[model samples]
Target: MATINNTPAKPEPVLSAFIKAKCPRCRRGDIFASPTYSLSGQKMHETCSHCGLHYEREPGYWYVAMFVSYAFNVAEMVTVAVGTYILTGSNSPWLYVSLLLGIIFLLSPFNYRYSRVALLYWLTPGLNFEPWRSADKPENPQQH
Candidate 1:
């Protein structure tokens, strides 16, 4: 004769989950199947493991992510360029070019992984965090 606890589970913070690259809806399952900097390159799960949300909502959905990635690249380049200028105070064009190129190459993986995450998390209008999906046990994990 045991009684069950009826309280709902606590939901994860949006910012924390976003940084961790968790499913936008459940914030439990991982969005990317592989690590960001893996040798095999980043691999994203087709659907959320917890809530089974299809990652690509429709045909050409991921094309939108290209724009997001471009924005991330631009912001990163600007920040790095400004930081390098302030730190070195160098007027050499080659210094700027080499440093910028190197930095962009290193950060490409990060940009690729987060761009899709950003698309799903913020750009998609209909998708939002569903508290019920974040339960310790999802009602139907394969429903997507």
Candidate 2:
């Protein structure tokens, strides 16, 4: 008789895992407690449900996500401005201002959600996907 391991036969792809907002380490458990556009507002799980990896590495870790959010905002603003100019060719400042403001308002949630996701996925130095953690059952499931 052969023994079966708990690990997944094939691990999930990085991009798919990131888009689904799975835990950076486990890639099986969700990172966010609530949906991106939830009425109650987005909520994040403190730790990975599968592997028990803490979401926040240390105190004030999330503050760094603010800078990530800021970068997202600037990129979004520039894209909107350039796109508006190309499509409308308007010299009016009001048009640009109004469009930019509307865009910022509309995309705030997206920026908020993705900034943190980006931070966990790319910016954090040590955190990386562990294929073994994506198993059907974690070796030890206690929250870290």
- State residue 38's C-alpha deviation in candidate 1, in Å: 0.5
TM-score of 2: 0.90
Model 1: runs farther than 4 Å from truth? 1-6, 139-144
Positional deviation of 18 in candidate 1, in angstroms? Answer: 0.6
Runs of candidate 2 exceeding 4 Å displacement? 1-7, 140-144
Please, what are the lDDT tens digits per residue for candidate 1 over residues 8-123?
46777999999899999988889988988998888889988877888899999999999999999899889989998999999999998998899889998999988999999999
In order of listing, the candidates' clash counts read 0, 0
What TM-score against the true fold does each predicted structure earn? 0.89, 0.90
**Candidate 2 minimal-lDDT segment of 10 residues:** 1-10
